[model samples]
Target: MWSLFALLLGLVVGSFLNVVIHRIPRKESIAFPPSRCPHCGHPLGPLDLVPVLSYLLLKGRCRYCARPISPRYPLVEALTGGLFLLASRFYPPGVEAFLVFAFLAFLVALSFLDLDTFELPD
Candidate 1:
């Protein structure tokens, strides 16, 4: 169904948003260098990057470093997925729902960035 598709899409986008939230304020390129374990700077492989499920399966620690990962990662992914499902119900399966998803995603990024840095990026 459209709701399921939207939720999955949101989860994937939320994963990318993690990179955005981490690199944007630091003026780092979001596209290059790929995702890594922050504690060890080891490039993360596919199994290490499965949104909320990976965090749960790994028990919230980096596999490479055994350091605690922030719970915010899964929280954001779930929130985005929830928002996408909600938007799909409200706006139907069309461009409007897609726009709503984009807006909601932008807001989520802004919110976490503000919390993490005490300032919002331009």
Candidate 2:
């Protein structure tokens, strides 16, 4: 059950990480504009934003404009979920696990940023 909880939390965090990856490089505020379809600029609603599930349900296309969505979104969510599950299994319940999670989050963020900008931010 704890592993499942961690996986869910990872998925949610991965969703936020997508926002961070897209907005941070562009100097945009992550909190102001909600997640939207990049190709169409459509403001995504709840159903359109459910991590990996939404991508699958929409057939990897935007609900509003039928634009092909990037597969990276679901890939990041799955990767984060798997990492969280792995961390839960390896680290005992304490500060160690928390530190592992924090490290993983930074690595993931840096990875996406690299993919976006072709360079890591200094």
Tens digit of lDDT per residue, candidate 2, span 50-105? 98999999999999999899999898888888898899998866788878877887
Question: Clash pairs of candidate 1?
Answer: none
What TM-score, over all chains together, does every model reach? 0.94, 0.92
Q: Top model by TM-score, which number?
A: 1
- Compared with the true structure, all predictions reach lDDT values of 0.91, 0.87
In candidate 1, clashing pairs total 0
The local lDDT score (0 to 100) that residue 15 gets in candidate 1 is 89
